[model samples]
Target: MNGSEVQFWSFVTAALLMIIGIYAIIFMDNIIKKIIGVMLIGDGVNLVLITEGFKPGGIVPIISEKLYNQSPGIFQEFADQASYSLPFALVLTNIVIGASTLAVLLGITIKLYQHYNSLSVHEIFKEEKI
Candidate 1:
């Protein structure tokens, strides 16, 4: 496939994942479904971060005097452009945070299921006093 076509598919895949997550959150009554939906949304967000980090025909941003000397103009041009590493790093951090949050939330869900003996989120909340 052509490069653009490939990129388009990549975006579409991410989008579809996000849509599925949203649907899961909206229609599913089980607490697990909500957690899965949140995870799917996180995946879609990570995909967006990856797409942003892509620089077409661009090399990794490794700065060094020797490399710069070899291609002085090229190095300057590359430096002038934005680097992908920062966004990539941020995305990685966010992924870790999302995972941690999901784990905590899932633990709470499990405890809730143990106490309630049902997977229905509405029932769990309904049993609450306020």
Candidate 2:
């Protein structure tokens, strides 16, 4: 209901998203699930970065005459250093990479399916001659 409560919930939700993503990556058998797991982890991480940038009553980092009239908080420098943009950008790059990897994996999966007429990974491996 209050600010601290909201912040606490945000962190908890972020942590849960991260945990779910890890579990999906480790335990899912399908290649698609693994890719989705990676995305879920990315979501959690992005949430954490944005959350860290939160400061109660803090203004946007834009420079304006009114803003200049106000003091940048004592932690402003640190906050600026820890801004979320870079991390978000990194996640975007990773997502693109992840998608490419998934596409390659899907191609492999499709080839296996065509050759063996089955989608089960174990079946595909059993059909392998070498």
**lDDT by residue for model 2 (1-130), tens:** 7656766787898999999999987887665676678778877876776667555545555455665557656356646543344555666676687678778878976886788787554565564686
Best by lDDT: 1
Q: What is the C-alpha lDDT of each candidate?
A: 0.83, 0.69
Model 1 C-alpha lDDT versus the unseen true structure: 0.83
The TM-score measured for candidate 2 stands at: 0.59
- Candidate with maximal TM-score: 1
lDDT of 1 by residue, 1-130 (tens): 7656666777888899899999999999999998999899889888877777766555677778887789878766877664577768988899899989998998999898899999897888786785
How many backbone clashes can be found in candidate 1?
Answer: 0
RMSD to true structure for each model, in Å: 2.5, 4.8
